[model samples]
Each structure stands twice: as C-alpha cells, then as structure tokens.
Target chain A: MSERPAHGWQTVREEVLRRIAEKIWRPGDPIPNEADLAAELGCARATVNRALRSLSDDGLLDRRRKGGTRIARQPVGRATIEIPLIRTAIAERGARYGYRLIERQEAVAPGAVSAALGTAADAAFLHVVSLHLADEAPYALEDRWIVLGTVPEARDEGFEAISANEWLVRHLPFTRAESEFSAVPAAAARSGALDTAPGDALIVHRRRTWLGDKPITQVDMTFAPGHRIRTQQ
Target chain B: MSERPAHGWQTVREEVLRRIAEKIWRPGDPIPNEADLAAELGCARATVNRALRSLSDDGLLDRRRKGGTRIARQPVGRATIEIPLIRTAIAERGARYGYRLIERQEAVAPGAVSAALGTAADAAFLHVVSLHLADEAPYALEDRWIVLGTVPEARDEGFEAISANEWLVRHLPFTRAESEFSAVPAAAARSGALDTAPGDALIVHRRRTWLGDKPITQVDMTFAPGHRIRTQQ
Candidate 1:
C-alpha cells in the first residue's frame, strides 16, 4: 500500500465512486471492510466510515452495522429539491419580482385543509390569496391558510405590502415542514389569476410548516404552464 | 459546561437545531465558534464541527472557512426526492405492478432530446415507449432514449420481460444525473397511454444520466393526474 497522507473523506468518496463507475466494485457485491480499505488506501478508518455513510445517504451503498457494506442492488436516485422564496427565485432568474394580494379574510378551513393541518374541520384560519409576478407577468398564484391559534399576529396584518409567505418566513421559524408536488388543471379562478387558459396544465407545490408539534401554515402555489424545477447531482 | 461524555454529533446537532428553532440563535446572526461551542458543550471540537457541517448541508446554517458559521438569513427548505423503479414504487404502494411495451425503435434524436443528452441533433438513439400499471390501472407513461454507443448491450436486449430502467440499474452505473420536474398537458398519444383525457395535467419527471462525461440515457416519466410526490422534513 502506498504511504500517502489522508487527503480527506471527499477524496476517498471520489475514489470509491470511480471504482463503482468502472465496475471494479460490482453491484450487489460486498466491499472490503473499513479497516482493510483504510490500510490499503492509507486513510483513517473513521474517514472510510464517513465516506461510506455518505454513500449510504445517497442511496448508493448499503452499510449495515454488523452485516458489513455492499453495493446497493437497486440503487435509487436521490435529488434535493430546494424550495426558495418566490422573490428570491425570480431574482435568481434575472426577472423583476412582483406581488399582488387578491383576498384576505378569516374563514372556516376546508375539510382537506384542516386535515392537512391536523385541526378541526370548522377551525377558523386566516385565508390569504395572492399572485406572484415575474417581469410584470403572472408567475404563480398562491393560496394560503394560516392557523390563527398558532399565528395570532397574522390576524392584525393587512398583508398588502408583503406576502403571507414572506411575512411568515421572516417572523416565524418552523422546526418541521412537509411538501407535496403535483400537477393540476387550472380552474377558472386559478386560470384568471395566472393568466392561463382554463384546463391548462399547472405545477402546484403544497407545503405545510410546523413549529414543534403545532401547525403553523399551509400554502399552495400554482405555477403557470411550462414551469420546471430542475436539479443536478 | 456539562461533564457528560459526548453522546454523539447527532445529539449536538439536535441541541443546535433547538437553539435555532427557539430563536436563541437568530437568523443572520453569527453562531458560537466551534471551539467555544465544543468547550461549552463538553465535546470534542471535531464533534462540533461535524454537527455544524451537517446543519450547513441541511441549508439551516451558513458556514465559511474564515468567517465562521451563521444562521441562514433565508433558510431554504430542502426535500429529498427518491426516484425508484416504477415496479418498485408500485409494489411499495401495495399494488400489483405491470408493464407493457408500447413502441421500440431506433430513431434520430429530436433537437430537444439531443440537447438534453449533450449529443448531436441527428444522432441515432434507441427509443422506447412503455406504460406502467398498478392494480390494472394506468400509472405512469415512460418515454426514453438510450445512447447506443454508451449502452451497446441494450441494442441486443429485447427489454421485453424487464424494463430498460431496471436493466440499466443492473448492468450500468452512472456518475452523475440531472432531473427536472414539470407539468404538461397530455398529448393525444400520452393521454391514450395513460388512459386520461386530452389536456389533462400530468406530472412529468425528466431525467438524464451520465457515466463520467458520456451520456447514457434520457427518460421522461409522466404520472397520471392526482398523483403527488410528497416528502416530510
């Protein structure tokens, strides 16, 4: 074994990936033990462990406490989707960002919305509807429901200058969140809000955030047709 | 400082996350240095560093080599999407999985397809169209283009019993991949394959895989309406 100093876990990870790509370590095959690999590569066993743990997180390897490590039989592809503020996203695309408040009121939460937030069906929520614009064109239509019990301050704010999305992000920090991505045909109201023809396909991102165990807010943002979220890995 | 033995970096991470969630460490504020935190928490500096690094990876903290770490001003919510084999996905939903080959041929790649694959527009590619089913109902429609040069064995394989998606996972490995999620109006052919009405909104997942710098395959999988990809964090 070459007596090279340990460069880092990242270097070890790249070497392992190269071996996998070259089929030197074939799929479903057991890899050398960490101590053996460390000795051969002139790296600490902890470095090998870290690299393997990271590969496991990426769904590329199976590392068991006692069963040893093996190449994943059916490696799954994992991609990270970063949900950013609409204004930030628009700015990143080099477009001018705009926001318009359509409606805001305290209304009874719908059954589905209530269920999503784990609240009573007849619970009152601060409902806010708004439109996000890019370069003076309709970009996304947002419909949001803020739990009044969790965010009583929202009841006083008019939400005219800043969107509920931006306001909540600025004021509240959530400990947990859930997101769902789907496609839906634009309804009449949604089409009008987005300046799209009725029945046009639209991408919808639905998110619910919570502080500890208490529900905070739920929002659905429907993007205009042809919007795509892309990621490279 | 607590004299307890370092439970692990994970425990330290949880404590840090609690501090952030409770606003003890406000957004955009510089966090305690690793050495200071380690001393206060009675852990190794490396443990504090690892915890901070993990938080940074989660987009909750911003770390700099010289400037130190700080709470992210605009913390981005990250969701990990796992793209599994269609059959496996169906099985996980407790449904019987089925697949039918719709079309298979060698065709000149379209301009958009070639651009996505980083190949010549007129390059010849093996094109395959198929439908996946769950519980005897249409699930997802898959359209794929495979580079013959990168996957020569595919030219010989019929892909009758197994899908190219599974076959490639078994035979080849990719070093890099890109995925795009979008909403599209189903064309006549796609609608027929998915058994949905024309103009129905479909969630389309497009992916391209590369082995090193050489392109391997590009595929588009369109899910039927009402299908959502959900993740929690």
Candidate 2:
C-alpha cells in the first residue's frame, strides 16, 4: 500500500453513491467485499467500511447488524409546504371566486358563549351568514358566530361588506392553532356548496386558533367535490 | 336565567375531533353558526368557535382571508419514510430481500472519488461489489469503493463471513445528510439483476451523509416495479 496520507475512503463512498444515483448499480444488489476491493484499488480494505457505514444512517441504505449494506427498496416520502391565495386558486383553475352575505344578527350570548369568555349570559355577539363562489359557482355557504365579549371592538367590525376570513387576518396576530379532518356524507343544503348530489362524500375540517392561550377564533370548512388536500415540504 | 356550569362545548370539540378520526366530517364542511346553535343547545357561541379554530392548526382545515373556511384537499403525494429494513421488507412482502458478496479488490482511490473527498490520487482504497434481493429476487446491485486513508480502523475489517452493513451501523455516528431522487432506464447488468425486460421506468434515490463536517457515507438505491414508498408523521 502506498504511504499516502489518510482521507482516501471518502472518495470511495462518493463514487459509490454516484454510481447508485446514476443507476449504475441497483437496490438489493450485492457489491464487492473489502479484500477484493483493496486489491483492485491498490489500497487497504479498511477504507471501504468507512463509506458504507454512513449510508445506513439517513434511512437510505439498509444494513443489518450482521448483514451487508443494500439499497432501500422503498424511498422516504418528502413533504412540501404550499400556501395558495383563494382568488388565485379560483382564477387559475378556470373558475371564479365569489361571495354573498346572507344574514346578519346581533344577539345576547347564551350561557355557553358567556361562560366561554367568563362573561354574563347576555354578552353581546354578532352572527352572520354568507355564500361563497368559485368560478362563479356556489362553493361554500358559511354561517358564523363572533363573540364581542373580549373583542368588544367587534361590535363595529364592518363584517357586512368584508368577510370574517379577511377581517381577522388583517386585524389579528393569531399564534396558536389546531385542526381535525374527516369525511362525511353531505346534507341537502350543505351539499349544494360543492355542487354534489346529496349524500356524496365531503371532506370536512374543524379548526380553532388562539393568541397565546386565549382562544381567538374557530371555524368549520367544507370543500367541493374532487378537491384535494395536500401538505408538502 | 338559571345559571348552569357549561362543559359540553369542550366535549363537543373532542367529539368533533374523534369524528374526523372516524372519517365522519371530511376535509371541508360548513358547520352551524353560534347563534343558531345556541338556540339549539341553549348555550354560547364562544364554545363552538373554540372547537373549530383548534381543528384548523392540525393541518386539517383551510381558512381563507375572505373566501370562508373550506376543507383542505388532500395532495396527491405524501411523505413516506424509507425505513432501512431489508429482511422484513423482503420476507414480509412475499418478495425477498437478499444480499450476496461479490469480488473485493484493493486499489488507489478513483478520480471521481478523490474529487468528492477533496483528496489527491495515490490514496489507499478498497473496491467491492454486492447484490441485494427482494422476494427471492435480485433487486439492487452495489459497486462500491471505500477509503482507507480516512477510516484507518477499517483496515482490520474482513468480508469473508460478516456483512459490511452490519459492521458499519455499530461503529459510525452520522450527522448531516443530502438526498436526490430521479428516474432512469435499466442498464446492461441491471436488466439481469432486477430480472426486468429492460427499458422500463425505475425510481432511484441517491444519498450522502456526513458526521459533523467530515463526510461519512454516500449511497444510491434503485426500485423495481410494483414497489410503493410512503412517508408520514
């Protein structure tokens, strides 16, 4: 063996990695052992072990405590984050995003809402209903309730023209959030939101958010038919 | 008004989350607003908002600035972790995960190998070839080269009876990793090792990892038809 300074093994590992990436080799394929490789490269067998050990960590190569290293049959799934704008999503998809106000009411909080905010049962509240459109088509019909107990400023929040969804983002600094998902058969009135025939499968999401530990907002959303959900990083 | 402690809203949110787990409420469905709901339950609207907003953060809901909240659409792809398991993945699937040692040769580091390690030629190394299996079928073939210069301890390791994958995991401590994925047609020997007809689509993963700043390992993996990869939290 040449008396060259150490650090040669890294080269071995990289070349091997490239061959594998280029499909020069394949998954589940065995490779040469150390002694044989040492002779071929005119070096020592010790160098090859250093490289193989590293592949085992990233969940790419499977190495048994006693078995040799091999390419993974399955791959690690990658996640990507995708945040889209509603108007953009609609316009790009050959549809229109529309909105309509349905009903507006002011009422005294019953016991539950009052208790939620540690207020009196008659605490003031705002209630509103609206329909949403995508591509000029009915997409979602929303019925929402807002508490004005802690957010007494909400008494004049001007929700009649601006939607609650838009209002909060511009005005709030929400920090914490939680969500749940499921699939259910649609009811007649709600099923019309997705243009699906009644009794069709609809994906549903329920959510709540808080600024610190203080609850800020809650919402329930329903999607149209053939709409997909994805989270990628 | 009779004053009664309210606890059911919390219970309702919990039930809603459970319903999501049970696929009852899908990704998107508009829920009843607070006032209308208070009339039904004789409670408060604050309770409902708490439940809904919590569900939003769990990646199950889409609340827009103005479009109203809607159930998220599931993305086509998912995160799939390629757990490094050879025997279980092979035998369990009725397909085989297999391995076999090929020739081992000692030599100087190859040109590409030296460049990756930022080393000069005349560096000592070992070259090896091995075969991997699936369902009693040859799946991946490895042609690797190891460097003795960096991993001096590797000089003592032998390949006659013991496999390299087994030895490396017990010894190495890898920290950083990089991975790339692509597709390719089959090569000459790959056609035989994979038993494929050749000219078929194959998924591949190329990965390299390091211990701290010192590069530790590099590996490539290829997949056959009818193989699925899944990654999730």
True-vs-predicted CA distance for residue A2, candidate 2, Å: 49
TM-score of 2: 0.40
DockQ of candidate 1 compared with the true complex: 0.44
Listed in order, the DockQ scores are 0.44, 0.03
Residue-level lDDT of model 2, residues A12-93, one tens digit each, is: 6666666554445556665666677577766657776666666655444676656666665442223232323344455677
Candidate 1 CAPRI-style tier:
acceptable
Model 1, span B109-210: residue lDDT tens: 888888988988887799988888999899998899998867766888887888888888997767678999998876634567787876578899999998
Instruction: For candidate 1, write residues A1-233 as lDDT tens digits.
Output: 35344578877888888787666887788899999999998888998988888888766788888879888876477778988889889999999999999999999988999998898888879999999999999999989999987777788899999999888887666767898999887763556788887657888999998865668899999998889998888
Q: How does residue A19 of candidate 2 score in lDDT?
A: 59
For model 2, residues B1-233, the per-residue Cα lDDT tens digits are 35333555665556555544333544555444546645665556676566557656644456676666554543321223443534445666787456777756777756776566555577776665566677567765555555555444556776545444444444443445555444344543443566654334344444554543454444445555334343222
C-alpha positional error of residue B104 in candidate 1 after TM-score superposition, expressed in Å:
1.1
User: What lDDT does the true structure give each of the candidates?
Assistant: 0.84, 0.53
Q: Is the docking of candidate 2 incorrect, acceptable, medium or high quality?
A: incorrect
Name the runs in model 2 displaced over 4 angstroms: A1-233, B1-57, B61-78, B94-97, B107-125, B147-150, B188-191
Candidate that scores best on TM-score: 1
